[model samples]
Target: MDDIMRAIFACIPGMRSPASPGGCLSAAFGGGDDDGEEGEGEGEDRISRLPDAVLSSIVSRLPVKDGARTAVLSPRWRRVWASTPLVLDDADLLPDDDGPQIFWRDVADAVSRVLAAHPGPFRCVRLTNACSYAGSRGAAALSRWLGVLAAKGVQELVLVFLHAWPVRVEPPADVLRVSSLRRLYLGLWRSFPDTEHLRPGADVFPNLVELGICRTDIKAKDLDRLLQCSPALETLAFVVSYNTQPNVRVRSRSLRCVLFWMSIAEELAVVVAPRLERLILWNGCPCTRRVRRDFRTRVKIGYTPELKVLGYLEPRIHVLEIANTVIEAGTKPSPGTMVPTVKVLAMKVRFGVRQEAKMLLSFLRCFPNVETLHIMSAEADEPTGKLNFKLKFWQDVAPVECLKAHIKKVVFKNFRGERSELAFLRFVLERAQILQTLVVVLTDGDGDHASQEELGNRLKPLIYSTHRASKCAEFFIFVRCGGTSWSFRTASDLSRSDPFDC
Candidate 1:
């Protein structure tokens, strides 16, 4: 306290240092009439004079400790802190260099105290400390804090347990009881409560609008129940849970976006989602330490008429089904096979492989209304039959209707400038009559400076052929090192419209 006061005093030349930190803060924010002229008549503790509502708003935005510390400023501010809706984040309570080492137990205790102190109506709270409630005592601690939150009516809550994997300690079913929650994210939990057999009018997550479950052990039935309970849920995300293999059936009328990332799941069936717009699937690859689970996740699209954004659909990995028909490489594109509602589409294709190229064609044919297209050029390991399936394939295939009419933008990722890749670029440049922008994200060639110049010259020839498909098209080139680390916020953000626009 003395040191903090001394530091504040050191900043001012003639001002005497306060003996206590509280006095220093009082002088800073709770200044009297004498201090008003010190800073050119602008030092009249204007913050302290603010209306209680305005002051409470300011305090609510601060970290838990910082907001609570404002109490020492004045009785008015103290009252403000007490009255304002609590916004706590456990990450903000970490130990400083001068402070004593803070263990998880200490943080948990502090969080409990903070939750208890603030009377009611928690606006947003994120608890991400690696707190291992070891035994019965820890279990009791968890229940006590969760009980506080449930009683207080927390609106938005994100609880990420950073404990050791595989030992997912189940938090009490009090989680489902927080009917006040409008948004909830639970990471590394065992399971969500099964409220399937609840009484006639029993409320289960009645107010939850956005629910995110990550690395949790969830069953298909429980997932269904969660959906059934959360009638207002507009967005649902299941991310990277190797322990659970859920054949997710989307049966919610309110769900607009579903993000499935790095999860070892069997299938995702949009059976009854009328409002669903985006179905984003990232990696099916295995996690770093775990034994590789089979990556195929059959995607079935049924009753989703409002669906607009689709994919990162790997040609080899995902088995696409539309209107109860499984989309195959040889399946002819017809009215029954198409999803006419999809506008923005993304696909992972190995243009070098003949089968995948054909599959890519089939997938494109299925989405006839696609306006903006993103093609991720996947690297081929072993040839899936004939190699370097060139421009002839693109020229000979049944005309891709979207290319000639609907497509306004196309982003080709990992553009290695191979014969097949260049041929496709030539194909698009020649065919997409309405194309507005073309982006080529290269795979960062190993060529030297001179070789790079030669490659550039080659690309220019493709960019400027005797073709006049789109007269006003702009072009750009970028290098893709690996990629950005995926997150729920980035993937499920409907605002991004095009994930590959970057």
Candidate 2:
């Protein structure tokens, strides 16, 4: 158990020191015998020696089970959990055979006890448990706990109880109305008939800056009302849960950094924030066999002039990350619409046929100023076809004349020695007027491994082939992924210009 724990602890990113002995034993091995006085002393020794602030930080990130066990470590540790702020992360919460009523009852009881034991104002409170409990009793218990924390003047409150209780229980509006609440992350817990009943504009979170919600089923009117209430909100992130047929138009005046992640089913209608500097959207079809069934399907998308204001980086925005999506052929934006000012574009195209090449070429037309481009194969049953997609993609997208002027270098990692692949290198060599350097990264997956002798013999003819060969500054084919251990035979001297027998 200790060895297993040490292995796991070694994998902890950026953690230089060893894991706390108490935490390791408690989590990996069963809770060590604490029935006697000697056990109590051992627990106390682990708690008292460790830094309190470190312990607090560690406990906050851990699951409730692990965090609760720390309290049994020693007398000092017993009350530390209540004193330290709690960030209830429900990402790891999985359903069990135990009914919802019993589950939430236990959770609510534990939370209530902790809060009551330490009545001090907490730094933050995040409750994101989405379990279908039996009755409205569990919801009531949650509200009561939240009410207590609200009364205590908590700084950051994040209530995310999506699909937990069936009743349309309203959130503790009295707590949300508090001016002290700076960061609020409230997601949908229960269904609401109207925005007014939930008291949207009636309350104000004056100091609120950052708010995030996922799977929230707020209507257009309700969304507007909620936005109006938070006049000072700066960073707003929404991961749409439900697919509204017509799609809702989102407008935020004070929002600067907006992150919208929704399915392609919804219209991408969002009024461009004038003061917005960064807008990120994750909208693309899933990378699976399902896409093949949905191909050539024209989905309705909405846009407005407000989005066009930032002619450089709004509307569709920049820094795109689309995976396993086949963009319909013949779909082009308006004529005057110059591509947004894109700096870096990372795309994982799923389509295999010539259409994929055409789409790559099409997408590149929009990002004329793109400096770096990264493309990878998607996780599908079929392989990225035997064609020279990358070469074709680059040839069609990167105009020879323009590339020579702007593009500084070209790098092909998985370079197979196909005629098309060779033609790609030849094209770049012939076209790129200002091309300074060309890097070819080879892979052994292509075919049988050729020895260094065979490669040198093949290139021996190139020395006296033509003057174009001399212009090549660095024309060495990297072998076996090319690292420190890579052995390069000095086949012909670097200065040797003759192609004949050396």
Index of the highest-TM-score prediction = 1
- RMSD value for candidate 2: 12.3
Can you write out model 2's per-residue Cα lDDT over 362-389, one digit (the tens) per residue? 5545444544333322223354556664
List the pairs of residues colliding in candidate 1: none
Error of 1 at 192 (Å): 2.6
**Residue by residue across 378-398, what tens digits does model 1's lDDT show?**
788765665544535777767
**How high is the lDDT of residue 404 in model 1?**
79
Q: After superposition, how far is residue 298 of candidate 2 from its true place, in Å?
A: 8.7
**Cα lDDT over the full model 2:** 0.45
| Backbone clashes under 3 angstroms, per model | 0, 1
What lDDT score is found at residue 1 in candidate 1? 24
Cα-based lDDT for every prediction? 0.71, 0.45
Worst 10 residues of 1 by lDDT: 8-17
